[model samples]
Target chain A: MARTAGSSGPRTEEAIRSAGLALIATHGYAAMSLRQLAAEVGIQQGSLYNYFRNKQEFLFDLIRTHMQDLHAALDAALAPEGGDPVERLTRFVEFHVAYHVERPQQVFICYSELRSLEPDNLAAVVAMRRDYERKLSDILDAGRAAGVFRLDDVRMATLAILAMLSGICTWYKPGGRLAKDAVREIFLGMVLALARGEVPAEAVEAAPPPALSRRNGVARAGAA
Target chain B: MARTAGSSGPRTEEAIRSAGLALIATHGYAAMSLRQLAAEVGIQQGSLYNYFRNKQEFLFDLIRTHMQDLHAALDAALAPEGGDPVERLTRFVEFHVAYHVERPQQVFICYSELRSLEPDNLAAVVAMRRDYERKLSDILDAGRAAGVFRLDDVRMATLAILAMLSGICTWYKPGGRLAKDAVREIFLGMVLALARGEVPAEAVEAAPPPALSRRNGVARAGAA
Candidate 1:
């Protein structure tokens, strides 16, 4: 939804989008006003309309763009379809944890403000999400069919794995106890173990892997 | 924070709370007003102050009450601590799934509106939440020590399992394709598998357990 101002317009649009995500991430969407968003972006309130039709459209655009970026990134990061499901699933976990840990604010608003979306916008974003979930579900089904993944319900397993991986955004901190890749590997191990329904005897007693240390406990439970 | 009121006063307070949770769950805490909540409860706006000092207090009360109830119910449902950690963890999973499934709205608001809490209130509620997490982490730690749960990090496992089970609120429905007990069992299987780091071989190809069926794919996704 760029306007005729060319380069400047896209720059301003990106600014508005970024500021809108921040504002909505901090304040509920119903409580965020276009006036405040404009101020944050250093643009006039009317300029926001040049980027999108209205506040609803603005929110929808942010979410839709995130979903689009997510799908595209998954396509880029996902391993080839014909590989072992265990390796494919491990790559999926690593990519998800890495992507989400970097975009905590977007992830936060995407979940918290879904209620604020109008029906049509909500439906569109939800469809994009299912497409993403379907990718992982397919991996799980492949693994289950090949006798590698042990699951009572493939659907339940898919949701459980997604939720478990998506949860990283709630607690992960940059330059903290665990680096990004370290976190990804640790989570990948857990996801693979969970998906396979096999907890190796040594995995239970596996010493905390190198590059991973005790995460400082934070009081942010339930935020995600 | 109850007031010295007659029996009707307690009933009115309960009504205000019920209506407040519904309003907040639908429209979010920031957008919910005392007047709107009072109207929903069929009480005059002025009467709301008799129960809560203001809107912030009302929001805080709703969250605090939910946390308190959760802790109490968990305490009531949790197996004795000295028992096998596997059994204890199993009981925790059963208790969590059963409790959250029945209170979808409360679960939603508690997570989604945590940002709306003022700093001091947020700290209080967060502490309570960490206390709850500690209970499960303690179980994971115990299991790890007993050589039953294979994990690279006790903290990571705790968060992953909690987020995984709590996620059922996003999709579970009453009288839906899966019965409550069936959902509980399926999730319990996953949680146990995750904790033990071993996938049950039979679970992979096991016939669909009684009362559970494949969930027809629905459009809802990424709303969480």
Candidate 2:
């Protein structure tokens, strides 16, 4: 008899990955056991080693694959070289929101389980994260250079924007009040506003905008 | 013989709370043992029962206390009644960034460990979070009514602003390249711009801004 897909090696590996993500996300890394993971995957305890060397490698593989796939998708989604910075940034916001909205589990573990990775593994994940961040930073820089975007600091804006967009995964539920496209549109507006440095007229007149403040180390009012 | 403050009941409770926070932050809620927690606080395992009935209650107490304190602090920090929405929003931004930056561990556990909370505890914490979110929502609503701020959906805007500010706790390090004051200011700009519906002139020209699209359910360009 021909072998079924479910019993095949690749299918088994995928099941292990999915089950591992669910376990780690629920019980966290320190609490999860290979024995439990094996049971969850319907594989013998010893056979689990055929998929990965150990739990640490399994975790590293999960995160690395997520990041790699993200980069590839982002590269494909981003606007072409020499494109308008506004266009590029717009694409970025749209792409980021759409991507993160669908992968809440992966997103949760990626942020929460970073501490579980070993030193070298942690370094690799952080480097990959930085590489991802630089993609947005470059767009912001280009926008600033072109005078299409006004930002006090490109690096800070990159982090802020990523945080703002990635945050949707925390609370967003499918069939919730807002659809994904609505979320994308609203976030896109906010991101563009941020890049363009648009403050309401009242806010602008009431005080010197923080972006315009020249004093380096002196604290702003109410900051204390 | 006089008793040391560290040995006093209140001090001991505080120590337990701190140690519990550290353990849960590192190992997550499910994995952390009460025995380990007691050891960390330098108390007998049975003594932990003196403070809380069980691990679940202990977790709830920590989160509820954090939420209560946040509410009290926010109430104190917000601008006076009938103040300008711009002013009120500014105060909210400043207060949130300052508050969350100091309590990364608490902020982290509040977000990451919500899954571990039992049904009632989770509902209670969620309600507290909603109450907190409404404070910001009211400010945004007032701003829109006064024509000082523009937003498509007040609730979504509230969540976005909170997410953006809370994100600082993840990456912010004291004595880092940017001071807390600088981060507060930069984030303030982004939040205000988001509220004001500020879009770059170039971005506005390149496409119909998402905020302006009249279509309710139809997908936007490139969203597919």
Candidate 3:
């Protein structure tokens, strides 16, 4: 549903969406303004209605478009023939790391700003997110059942893993020492380490009871 | 650093911080008005300034208090005497899960609203968070150096692990299917499983080198 700016049509639309994403990302959804967005796009305030009905509509479009784009990218990355489930899952984490790291602005909106959408739009975005989460849950479940991964309670497992991936957006700044793939590779290793389990010899001596230690990357500190 | 409001003083300060935390958590910092916070505390708008210099100051104080509280609780739980790094670290995870689950609003503010703090205040908060992270890192290092835990890179290891723990806040609701302690126990189990590097032997035929197996989670053409 892209409208082309015969001359600078796409440019204006892109500008509007980019400004909206940035504003919503830095300032929460409700705090974002049509006035601020228009100025950010170098357009008069009223002109915004030409492209979007209102701020809510603009946000809905932004959330929908960004989620669709992410879903497509992740699906492609995890194509059936990609590799084994473990490798594909690692690729998914890598993709998540790259998406959150490279497009921090978009990532923030997809997360914190989706709430700004009106009821109908919010439902749509929620459905999309649920669908995506289901993909992760299924992958984990299959791995668990097939003896590829050993996670208990796939639902919580998926949430924990995705949360860890989303966090890449919160802290990862590209220019810092680690490149995108470096973080991905190590995180992949960590995920696999958790999924596949750890050193067998060490397990014999000190493995805590299963009920006490189920999470992977986010290790807990002692009680405070 | 509390000044007495006589008998009313301590309670009023508590009311103000609690109100500020709740407002900032739901509506966001920009949208939370001082007048609203005062109303929430059953005081006149102007009286809030007595407890806090301004709205930002109120938010600043709330955040600082939360961080300090987390530090104190964590220190109390991880008292260096009871257990090995694994058990100590597991207790830490359980503590985080329980605390964050019980106080979802504060957890939301700690994760989301901190960005809105003025530079100086933000720096203070960041320093506290960094200190907390370092404490977790120290445990990991202690475990690894002692030949108990194995990890590729200590820094990456720490971030990935802690992110998983804090990540719980985003999804936890006060009353749901999982109880706080149950979830915490699961996290502890998941992590300790990883720490000892024990994959359930059934998952792989030949040990999957480095990583065990890729995710088998994608449920294509099943739900949509």
Give TM-scores for every candidate, taking all chains together and pairing residue i with residue i.
Answer: 0.84, 0.86, 0.83
lDDT measured at residue B152 in model 2 versus the true structure, 0 to 100: 63
TM-score of chain A of each: 0.82, 0.84, 0.82
Among the numbered candidates, top TM-score falls to: 2
Q: Count the backbone clashes (under 3 Å) in each candidate.
A: 11, 1, 36
Poorest lDDT segment (10 consecutive residues) of candidate 3 chain B = B215-224
lDDT of 3 by residue, B176-219 (tens): 66656556755655566556543322332345445354422221
- Model 1 agreement with the true structure over A1-224: per-residue lDDT tens digits: 43434449768878988888888888868889999998998767887787898889888888888989989988876735455776577567767887899998898777767888999999998888889999999989999999988887889889999889888887787766766655665676667667877532223333432232222221111112
- Candidate ranking under lDDT, highest first, comes to 2, 1, 3
What ranking of all candidate models by DockQ puts the best one first?
2, 1, 3
Clashing pairs in 2: A193-B198
Off by over 4 Å in 2: A1-6, A31-36, A44-46, A200-224, B1-6, B200-224
lDDT of 2: 0.79
RMSD of 1: 10.2
Cα displacement (Å) at residue A50, model 1: 2.8
lDDT of 3 by residue, A1-224 (tens): 34424537578888988887878888777777788888998777887888888777777888888899999998887877645667567667778877788898888778876545668988999999999999888777767766777664577778877776777777787698788877776666666667655332233234343334333322132232
Q: Quote model 3's TM-score for chain B.
A: 0.80
DockQ-superior candidate, 1 or 3: 1
